[model samples]
Target chain A: DVKVTQSSRYLVKRTGEKVFLECVQDMDHENMFWYRQDPGLGLRLIYFSYDVKMKEKGDIPEGYSVSREKKERFSLILESASTNQTSMYLCASILGGRNTGELFFGEGSRLTVL
Target chain B: AQSVTQLDSHVSVSEGTPVLLRCNYSSSYSPSLFWYVQHPNKGLQLLLKYTSAATLVKGINGFEAEFKKSETSFHLTKPSAHMSDAAEYFCVVRFSGNTPLVFGKGTRLSVIA
Candidate 1:
């Protein structure tokens, strides 16, 4: 079974603090994604990395950045956390194949900004 | 560009009753459609997907969706609702060949005893 693990399941951070959310997949997938889910808005993509050291901005990428240093790990960085940034963060990975669209998602990290 | 729209924000059904969640999409190319379920405080789980192989797709947990090109809709359905089926359901569409999926607002399913 494929497993995607997030570093933290729940996190609380103060305003203006820098925060890091880590995600690691054991399946050796080549594509990793970061998304923030909000109530009534669904999951909006923040960043996606198709390969190591390669990244692309998604629809809502402001105030967020991502790092993919290795094949199995992807990290989401919040430069300066704010109250409005509080939301559930999700990480997903997909194998590099014809069906690169099917994603295996982590449990998710719920962040609360104060 | 691609987008998806879930017509209903919420749907309530009794156990053993049929379940239906409507979703519409817009894409320049033939798109791959997917239905995912997200339980409270959990990540999204893939329910089913349609990639033009078959119009009617069957997914896990007895759920299925039919892709209609005329209506540009992919609505999920099930014969009977289970208490475990109560969750937030999202309709997703991704254009072929490496494009990220676009998700609908999602429909919350509530199963009543």
Candidate 2:
């Protein structure tokens, strides 16, 4: 069974504080992603990393950043958390080649910024 | 650009009734299609996938989806709705290369007793 682990199940941060959400995949998948889920809008991709030290911006990457220092780990960063940044964050991963579009997802981290 | 469209925002059905969730996609080439279910406060789970193999794809938990190239549609269906089947469904599309999935807004399914 493939397992994607998220470091935090829930988090609360104050405005202007720096926030970090960590994710690790035991499957050693080469591709990792960060997405913020909101009501009605659904899951919007924030950033994705296809390789260590390589990252790409997704549709909704404006208020977020990501780090992939290791093949099995990816981290999402909120430089300065704000109330509007409150949302459920999801981490996902897929094998590098010919993965057939199958994505394994983590349990998700719900963050609330006050 | 690849895109996915989930036709309904919500669908309600009683247990033992049929279930249908409509989805459509637009892609420049033959696309990889998937249906994912997300329970409340949980992560997304893959229900089924269509990758140009068989038109009809059977998935976990007695669910299936048919890929129609002519209509550019991939609709999920189940014979009977179960209480556990009540979850949010997302239609997803992935074009060739290393691109990630393009997800629809999702359709919420509610199962009534």
Candidate 3:
């Protein structure tokens, strides 16, 4: 089974603090993504990395950045946490190829900024 | 640009009642379609997918979805609703491997006993 592991299931951070949310997938898929989920708004993509050291901004990339130093790992970084940034973060990975496949997701990390 | 539309924001059904969640998409070319379920405090799970090989696709937890190109719709259905069925359901569309998956706003299902 493909397992996507999130380093933190829950986190609480103060305003102006830097936050890091890590995700690792054992599947070694070439494509990895970070998404922010909120009530009513649903899931919005933040960033996606198709290859190591290569990243693309998504619809809601503001206030967030990502790092993909390794093929199996992707990290979401919040430069300065704020109340508005409090939301559930999700990580997903899919194989890069001609076939469009469903993504394998992590357990998710819920962050609260105060 | 391709997009997915989930008709209802929320749907309530009595236990043992039939379930129907409407979804529609707009795309110039044939795209891969999927239905994903997210339980409270949990990650998303793929319920089913429609890639054009089969119009009617069966999925986990007795959930199924039918892809109708004529209506540009892929509606999820279940014979009966259970309490465990309560979750947020998202309709996703992927134009190709190069494109990001487009997710609908999602429909929250509430099952009443």
Candidate 4:
């Protein structure tokens, strides 16, 4: 079975602090993504990486950045955390091909900014 | 761009009754559709998917969905509702390969005994 692991299951940070959420996948999938889930708003894509060191901004990329230094690891970075940034963060990976790829997701990291 | 719309925000059903969650989608091209279930404080799990190969797709936990291209809808259904099946259900769509998956707001399922 494919497994995607997130470094932290829960986190708390003060306003204006820097925060990092890490995700790693054992399947060596080429596509990785970061999404923030909120009630009524659904899951909004923050960033995604298609290859090592290659990244693209998603629909809601403001105040967030991502790093993909290796094929197995993807990191979400909040330059300066704010209270509005408190939400559930999800990471997903998919095999980069035309075989109807389904996203394998991590357990998710819930971040709280106070 | 591809998008999904979940018609109901909350659905309540009695245990052992049939379950239905409505979804509609819009896409420029033929889209790949999916149904996902998320338990409280947990990640989303794939329930089923439609890739044009089959219109009626069966999924885990006795759930199924039928894709209707003419109506632009893919609705999830279950033979019998169980308490464990209560969760937030999301409808998702992808335009093509290599693009991000678009999700609906989600429908919260509540099963009553």
TM-score for each model: 0.94, 0.96, 0.96, 0.96
lDDT string for model 3 (A57-77, tens) is: 999899999999999999999
Which model, 1 or 2, shows the larger DockQ? 2
Across B1-113, the per-residue lDDT of candidate 1 in tens digits comes to 67789999999999999999999998445778899999986678999999878899999999999999989999999999999999999998876655577789999999999
What class would a CAPRI assessor give candidate 1's docking?
medium
Better of 1 and 3 by lDDT: 3
Off by over 4 Å in 4: none
Model 4 Cα shift for residue A101 (angstroms): 2.5
Worst 10 residues of 2 chain A by lDDT: A94-103
Off by over 4 Å in 3: none
lDDT of 4 at A111: 97
DockQ of each: 0.58, 0.67, 0.74, 0.72
TM-score of chain A of each: 0.96, 0.96, 0.97, 0.97
DockQ winner between candidates 1 and 3: 3
On the 0 to 100 scale, the lDDT of residue B106 in model 3 is 100
Clashing pairs in 4: none
Candidate 4 chain B has its poorest 10 consecutive residues by lDDT at B25-34
Kindly list the per-residue Cα lDDT of model 2 for residues A46-74, writing each as its tens digit. 99988899999999888788989899999
lDDT of 1 by residue, A1-114 (tens): 779999999999999999999999998888888988999999999999888998999999999989999999999999999999999999988765456457789999999999
- Superposed by TM-score, candidate 4 places the C-alpha of residue B66 at a distance from the truth, in angstroms, of 0.5
Q: Model 4: per-residue lDDT, tens digit, A1-114?
A: 789999999999999999999999999799999999999888999999888999999999999999999999999999999999999999999877556667889999999999
Candidate 4 chain B TM? 0.95
